[model samples]
Target: MSTEENSGALPLPQDDPVVSAGLDIAMRWGAALGGPEKLKIAFEALEPQLKREHQLRLKQLDMQREATARAEENAREAAERMVRLAQQKRQHALRMTGLWLGAGVSFAMLVAGVYVARDMWWLSLFLWGPSLLAMAKLYTLRRSDPGDMQAVTLGMRSAANAAQQAPPPPVP
Candidate 1:
């Protein structure tokens, strides 16, 4: 054999076509036994990649669960803060009402003390004078400002009633 044939170089075709066809068939058979068998080998190699994708999806779901829990905690805290603010407002309103009532009572008691000391002999005018003055002052205050604090409305109503129930005007 020549040096080219020994080194497995290309060879010239035979003159007979029938002999060439038979040689081609024998070469194909030899290749079927010597080379890789299955044509779907690339598809088989993708199994591990599909499993890795499933693991990544599970990790994403865990992250979403943690985020949802944090949001719920924040919402609960906001609701508690709103309730605390509402309670503070209610306490402030009650304190304002108490102050108005205390002012009304102190003024009324001071007037009564003055009248009782003035009429030492006759105890009758002393008893009615302070009450009558207090009622008159309350009515005048209400007429001066109609939209004053709502807390004093109860006392204002009683003063108005007392003024009306007093004896009517005598003939001139």
Candidate 2:
């Protein structure tokens, strides 16, 4: 056999189901064979190199796992930050809307009061009717909105817990 065929196998790509399954089978075979004693002295000279390579591969996998975890944590934090930023923007806009609405309604009520005082009831209706209606609608929407941080955080926590609790697929 060519030396290339005798060389160690390539490090399997992380998270690859096929490679993982192949590795599982290989480990089972090794166990069934009752270890390298079966191969005996013919493979003895290469044992040190094999052990070194296995250790190196395990170290590499450890690094990959930690990196994957950090990447997931970063992604989760970024998503939460984005959600908070969006909520801040919505709150700011809502505050501004309320501020302007208050000012508009107060001025309209003042004008309507003046008109009522002058006995111009029809003009008073035109000034304050829509203002009151819009104010009522804004309050209603604010009450119904589900954009609070507590709600969003609860949803994210539940989803994360669900993912963590779920079992991996059968390896058969």
Candidate 3:
């Protein structure tokens, strides 16, 4: 390595701050340009553009918020409609079940009336029909209505048939 390369040396500025400031004044006086006025006009033009951009951003946010609210409202309405449809279906099923039960009860009563009339005419007329009518009225009560009376009646008939078929207990 050379000794000149190891020497601690630095370049110095050709002029001081006073000289630099004087040169700046002389150059500006020679140019005679409206520098600060042009800068002010540029800043004033940018202010309106920035304000417009900010307003547009706020409008976009508002529109998005409104769309979200509308979507939420639609979802809520759909849910309510689903609940209503389900309730309607349940009510229809209950009504159909009641109609079927009434029909079955009437059929059983008619068969019983025919059978009882052969042996006991007055008893069938005064007691059996009235008892059936009373039962029909009682069954019409909503709170007392069995949900699936057809299944229950079928179960009872099966039980009776099973009992008839079963052997009697040995004399114990």
Candidate with the greatest TM-score versus the true structure: 3
Give the TM-score (vs. native) of candidate 3. Answer: 0.55
Clash count of each predicted structure = 0, 0, 0
Q: Give lDDT tens digits, candidate 3, residues 83-152.
A: 9999999998987787678667866877876886655454345334444554555455443345345544
Off by over 4 Å in 1: 1-44, 120-172
What is the alpha-carbon lDDT for the whole of candidate 1?
Answer: 0.58
Model 2 per-residue lDDT tens digits across residues 1-172: 6323565976557599997798678656656767556545436767998999999999999999999999999999999999999999999998888767766666766666576644443344434454444444455444423334454455446545654665654566
Question: Would you give me the overall lDDT of model 2?
Answer: 0.64
What would the per-residue lDDT of candidate 1 be over residues 99-120, giving only the tens digit for each residue? 5664665566556656654433
Q: How many Å off is the CA of 100 in candidate 3? A: 0.5
Count: clashes, candidate 1: 0
Superposed Cα deviation of residue 15, candidate 1 (Å): 56
**True-structure RMSD for candidate 2:** 27.9
**Candidate achieving higher TM-score, 1 or 2:** 2
TM-score of each: 0.42, 0.46, 0.55
- What does candidate 1 score on TM? 0.42
